[model samples]
Target: MASQEKIKLVLLACGSFNPITNMHLRMFELARDHLEDTGRYKVVKGIISPVGDGYKKKGLVEACHRLEMARLATESSEWITVDDWESQQPEWVETAKVVRHHHAEVLSSENNSNGDDVDTGKYRKRRKMEKKSPSCMNPKADRPHLNLLCGADVLESFGVPNLWKPEDIEEIVGRYGVTCITRCGSDAEKFINQSDVLYKHRKNISVVREWVTNEISATHVRRALRRGQSVRYLLPDSVVRYIQDHSLYSAESEQKNAGVILAPLQRYSKTE
Candidate 1:
């Protein structure tokens, strides 16, 4: 039986999403099923936040295209929505900040639903002085919990040197928690056990094993697209059509843009 009062939760996935793949969308469903099965949490929303062009990673496409592809991929889902806040930013925002921003938005929405005016100043002050548990809000309250949804690879990236701040890890895992959707052959649990911070907050991390393994990734999709191979089912039809229409990831386009550094504004334009 379901709990009488289940904690409301929102799932946030932040990434390059160069071209959002089917696996990226399936992660939300896997996490929702895993969490709701526990009878303690109900996933209320799923948000996909694509990184801005400032990340400057290899094989990363324009933020606008990635944002649009994400929106198109999730347009049919009732619970999933695309947030452009991170993508529209002038530079890449930290993952912890993005999660916190979404949490505040959730709290603001809950307040608005009850006809209460959100006092921004008071909220900021409270957050600054918060010394309690990870979640600054009362667990018994009706507020929704915002958890970061990520793949096992990202979870392991916590060990990458200088890639993530220790404090940011605490803020994200301690405050909001994480719902990691792990694929087959991944050693997600082993990684968690090896980290001191992750081990300390182990309860806050929930790992959902994806039984029906899928290895579809954006890098592979881009490669196939560049070589003129079929990617009909690897991604949504709408997204595939969008890529074709804009000639994205084509050999010509890739060669033309290869090794060329573009400014933030220049990176937002679609491929010719």
Candidate 2:
């Protein structure tokens, strides 16, 4: 009997990450655990890549700020790391390009003898062709398998017009694979089946249903902050402190009122 070869799996989570939340980090862990349980993959790394300012999403903070906040959120986690490549891009590169770049980086670092880097050139050529040919089923074994990680909400939006190109969807779901963490009331299978391309490559899509929901979203957190409410446990302590020190999200008047409210509590606590 021969021992099965260990498959190195890396996850690239690209998004606004305007302010990294617990839910964002949780998806990585959920995906890693689910993949590892299959006994076919060894999850090595998870990279959180914030979208560049080129995305122009409303309420999106500066790329530098988002990058630092992500760093702070994941600094203590050993396997999870933050990548600024996407954040630093002068123009908004498509998600497929971001995934490919990271995959290339992984292959280059491994120094695999099987010409993993050469395959990237082939990928570029494939992108240029018009015909919808299925990508290579068997990629270089030595190269780590890189996949995109996102919430089910994102998965459902793939079919929306003007959001994702057909070629990009094929490449992302077909070539790179995706792990979608299911949100409450989201039917990933239904959405996948609705799209001809997504359905064809549905095998590459892994949907992990989350039973215990943590409905913590960046929007909700921002709203709470704006309303001068406590968001202590919703995010990591370091992230919370960063938000406080940097005065992010909260309106100027709200922050001033919050300070006034906290001063008395601070003084009373100090006396005790």
Over the stretch 51-97, how does candidate 1's per-residue lDDT look in tens digits?
A: 98777666777888999999999989999999999988887678888
Q: Candidate 2 at residue 148, lDDT?
A: 94
Highest TM-score against the true fold, candidate: 1
Q: Distance from true position, residue 28, model 2, in Å?
A: 0.8
lDDT of 2 by residue, 105-174 (tens): 7765664455445457674574444124332244335446788999999998886556666788889998
TM-score of each: 0.88, 0.82
Candidate 1: residue 60 lDDT (0-100): 76
Q: lDDT of candidate 2 vs native?
A: 0.79
The collision pairs in model 2 are none
Cα-based RMSD of candidate 2: 11.3
Error of 1 at 186 (Å): 2.0
